[model samples]
Target: MGPIATTFPVLGVAAWSSTGKTTLLVELLPRLRAAGLEVGVIKHAHHDFDIDKPGKDSYRLREAGAAPTLVASARRYALMQETPNQDEPDLVHLLSLMEPHAPDLVIVEGFKQWPIAKLVLYRDDIGDPGILACENVQAVALKGAAPDTLEASIVRLDLDNIDAIAHWILQWCAAFPDHER
Candidate 1:
């Protein structure tokens, strides 16, 4: 079969570590949901991580060589897959996993190198170089005053204004071809 079609809009919140990417999402998600959007999140971890707890049956199953250990409960469900000695799955593959639920938007927390349109977050105090020149960076969210060297055409958003940022994302999603808000 050919590749599955994806209709939902995807946006990445790109930033260096400790730049409040998760914190921004924590604030942004509820606003997006309240505005009647079903949002899915895809977070990329740079190191090994585990959602399953040790001694849990699901964890034991995974450790016992189950390719994907799925545990379901009345409230929610989780699927954990083992990829020992394997390369990390690319963004497309990961996004495909979200297709069944059909979220209105997918907010990616990392994958900064991917070509998806992203809002670059920065903290001037960290002194990390800006990623405005990177591919598909449509806007920048600054924690402090706008850097003097930033390009004038790039959209700048106040890092603390959750409402405005949420509004901007909603507008952007609506602008997507065949996208209905």
Candidate 2:
């Protein structure tokens, strides 16, 4: 199948561990739903993972060296394949391969280096100084003053205020409709 064309822009959540990024996402997702926009989530894992049970048919096929395994049902399906480890897939490639079911916007987690527009999440406790390291970061959901470079472009937000954060995101999305998937 050809790549799925996006109706809205793709967005990413970039933040250090324990900085409330996931918590904020949990809240933010529902608000987006209320606004009538389709949403999808993509999470990156640094380690390998198996989504199948060890003794299941699909898992057994994979363990027995099947190159590819597909598990399907009426509601959902998954395909797993073995591939050589590459440094990392680029944003476009990853999107192409994994984004067919993506909604109006695909919300990504843990891809700070990709050039896609991003919302940087930060807190004083995590002590991560790399929140501002990427060029395409459009906003920051932060607890306090962000790095000086982000002052002008960043929208300072208290992670606890789901309403404010959602409003800010809505405004940003309105201003940049082209960014939507």
Each model's C-alpha lDDT? 0.85, 0.73
Model 2 segments more than 4 A misplaced:
1-7, 147-149, 177-181
1-181 per-residue lDDT for model 1 (tens digits): 2323477988989988888999999999999999999999999988899999999998888888888888999999998877777676578888899999989999989988787888989888764665656677778888887778778887899988888899899988998778866
Question: Tens digits of per-residue lDDT for model 2 on 82-113?
Answer: 75676654456567655566566678888777
All-Cα superposition RMSD per candidate: 2.7, 3.8
Best by TM-score: 1
Give every collision pair in model 1: none
Poorest 10 consecutive residues by lDDT, candidate 1: 1-10
| TM-score for all models, in order of appearance | 0.92, 0.83
